[model samples]
Target: MKHQPHDAPPGDPDSALAGEAEGYLLARAHHDQARREAEDLCARMPWLTAAQAEDVARHYTRKRIDLTRQMLLSTVERASQLRQEYETRYAALRRDLLKLHAAGVCAALICLGGAGALASLLSR
Candidate 1:
């Protein structure tokens, strides 16, 4: 039910939360860098030279997008792994608690029985 970022790389919810992985931020930075690079190239490439500015821009943009997709996938997979681990640990703790509770109930019943028997013997 927890909401995650729609923009996050395919799998890295943890990286978005932790902000620790260089890989997770690569896509955003890459896109910015590509824009800057394309701008610089456009400024230098004279119109007289008839450079393919649009093609160059598209190529860099696509590369940045692809890298971002890769990062997203990695993040998502790690999050899923963490989720599974938590589930396993939670299940174990629940089992242990149930066992302890059962033991306590048994001990209480035994103590009550002993007390009742003692009282009956004293009455005789």
Candidate 2:
């Protein structure tokens, strides 16, 4: 028997939406943190000694930026994975819908053909 739409065994709408929303929020937060860190690095650079100031400032900014990039990358990767999963599900649903439509068409044709045959036999 074909599975019913309402009877989704798993990956229901609420859970999926929640997961996506969470990922988006995380990415946003990570981006904000990174921006703040960059600003701090710039503001503090002047106080640093000339001997190793540039290097130290660069290191601080680089570390924060790298971590932010990583966080955003992970968020993007998760979102990509979610999109792929949804695409796959939609493809399967489309296939099933087409099959159902074809079956209905075949049944109608069969019924008409049978009726025509019966009428011919009666006329004979």
Candidate 3:
């Protein structure tokens, strides 16, 4: 058996580690992209002093990160809503199917009872 870390919970440490690693990689990629965008913005206006360029880069990076965060939050909220709706619809459909099945069974039993009664009357 493989060993688990004492601080970790009972299941699948590998997946947890993978998720953390993926998050760090994405954060790094976003930072790199923001840095490149900031550089491009600074390059467009060559007249600014060093301090002014630095300020612009800082402001641009902050705004970009905030916008990305807001978009991710909105996407997560929408996904949650869709999951709830699909689950409710699935439950309703299952209930309808069960009701139909029960009705079919009852109909079959009634037909069998009528046939048995008819056979008894014919014999008499």
Candidate 4:
């Protein structure tokens, strides 16, 4: 019932790996482009001190890092939620299976006792 992310295909391992590789390439390209743009900014703005240009570049890098951090936190939260849901389902299934096993044992014992009584009556 869980939906696959836009990057990955569902149900096929090879396609999923390919999708992950594609996503990595795309992210790498984006980072490269951002770095190039930052360098160009520093090159074009000669009036700004070198330190100030570096600061500008750092600002962009920090923003990107912060965005990645937020995404990671969201993914962790989703994982925790899924873990809780699975635990709850497992507990319910275990309880039901236990009840079913007990019922079966009880039925077998009753049948055995009835057979024993019938055999005794036939012998008498």
Model 2, residue pairs in steric clash: none
Q: Ranking by lDDT, best first?
A: 3, 4, 1, 2
lDDT of 3 by residue, 4-45 (tens): 466666587785776677778897899789979998999999
Poorest 10 consecutive residues of model 3 by lDDT?
Answer: 1-10
What does the lDDT come to for candidate 3? 0.87
Question: Please, what is the whole-model Cα lDDT of each candidate in the order they appear?
Answer: 0.76, 0.74, 0.87, 0.81
Q: What's the residue-level lDDT of 62 in candidate 4?
A: 66
Residue 80 lDDT, candidate 2, scale 0-100: 86
In model 2, which range of ten residues has the least summed lDDT?
1-10
What lDDT score is found at residue 124 in candidate 4?
100
Predicted structure with the largest lDDT when compared to the true one: 3
Which numbered prediction scores highest in TM-score against the true structure? 3
What TM-score number comes out for model 1? Answer: 0.61
Give a tens-digit lDDT track for model 2, residues 1-124: 2212454545577656666777678867866676676557666767656656656656766687687678867987898899999999999999999999999999999999999999999999
Steric overlap count per candidate: 8, 0, 0, 0
Worst 10-residue lDDT window for candidate 1 reads 15-24
Regions of model 3 farther than 4 Å from truth? 1-11
Clashing pairs in 1: 9-72, 10-72, 10-73, 11-72, 11-75, 11-76, 12-75, 12-76
Q: State in Å the error of residue 2, model 1.
A: 11
> Any runs in candidate 4 off by more than 4 Å, and if so which?
1-52
lDDT of 2 at 60: 66
